[model samples]
Target: MAGNKQIIIAIDKDGYVKAEVSGVPGPDCKKYLSLIEEIVNGKATDETLTAEYYQQSTSSQNDQTSLNQQNG
Candidate 1:
């Protein structure tokens, strides 16, 4: 019973499909979007970052950078 991820897809009369991924954060969403594009054999011509995308904390990013530097 996991409710963490959801992908909602819609198709128009012209056979255009739009997919939206919910419950996933910013950087991670890019991977899913790319996969969708590949599966659909289409290119994403435009994109807008939602507010949730910019809500990531600086401390988390800094921690990852610190870890990478230490391991590199």
Candidate 2:
């Protein structure tokens, strides 16, 4: 949660759109992918998750777990 969140988008001459998200750890970066798809009115044909995607979120790391509580 302390890191900066950034979405960098690039458009090619052939109208291809490419987006890269940085400073966001874990699967939270997927949210930005959805947003970019919406803005471009297109669906993603492929996806490649980075090392950060496998890392846990900083906020989640600091969260206290309740013994009797279920995640759902």
Candidate 3:
């Protein structure tokens, strides 16, 4: 299960409401922060990013070698 992530939203005790995302790559993970802004009618403003998420999205694409290997 590589490249898989999850986002969580909830309502807490204080009536302030809450949203928490988990299981996502770090850092750039916050790039998705705006996704939750619509909840609770925009009562909150903040975001967090972690390193592990930023590091996981790299894709290795070798063009000629891939074709050559495919042919072989």
Candidate 4:
């Protein structure tokens, strides 16, 4: 149904399984991604996000440099 929150799981012929959940939007999507990885398979072991992958707007990006300086 259109009103239902759907979690669609798919498996390929090669035995690779993946899942996708609909209706969870924004930052919550990342939580769904983790759950999908944990449930479908362990294919998400090595994951990284690129600068372009960060779709949210923040006040500043310069703070990362400051954090690195503190660590050093």
TM-score of each: 0.60, 0.66, 0.46, 0.46
Model 2, residue pairs in steric clash? none
Stretch of 10 with least lDDT, candidate 1: 61-70
- For residues 1-72, write the lDDT of model 2, one tens digit per residue: 467676666666666666677676666676676677766667676666665566666622111111111122
- Tens-place lDDT per residue, model 1, 1-72, is 223666555556565666666556556666676666655566565555556656653211100100001111
Residue 43 alpha-carbon offset, candidate 1, angstroms: 1.8
Top TM-score prediction, candidate number:
2
Arrange candidates by TM-score, descending. 2, 1, 3, 4
Overlapping backbone residue pairs in candidate 2 total: 0
C-alpha lDDT of candidate 3 relative to the true structure? 0.42
Task: Report lDDT per candidate.
Answer: 0.49, 0.57, 0.42, 0.40
Could you tell me which residue pairs clash in candidate 3? Answer: 25-53, 26-50, 26-53, 27-50
Give the per-residue Cα lDDT of candidate 2 at 50. 64
TM-score of 4: 0.46
User: Which candidate wins on lDDT?
Assistant: 2
* Candidate 3 per-residue lDDT over residues 1-72, each given as its tens digit: 544555556554544444555555444445445555554445344444434434545521111100001111
lDDT-best of 2 and 4: 2
- Which candidate model has the greater TM-score, 3 or 4? 3
Candidate RMSDs in Å, in order, are: 13.1, 13.4, 18.0, 13.3
Give the C-alpha miss distance for residue 50 in model 4, angstroms.
Answer: 17
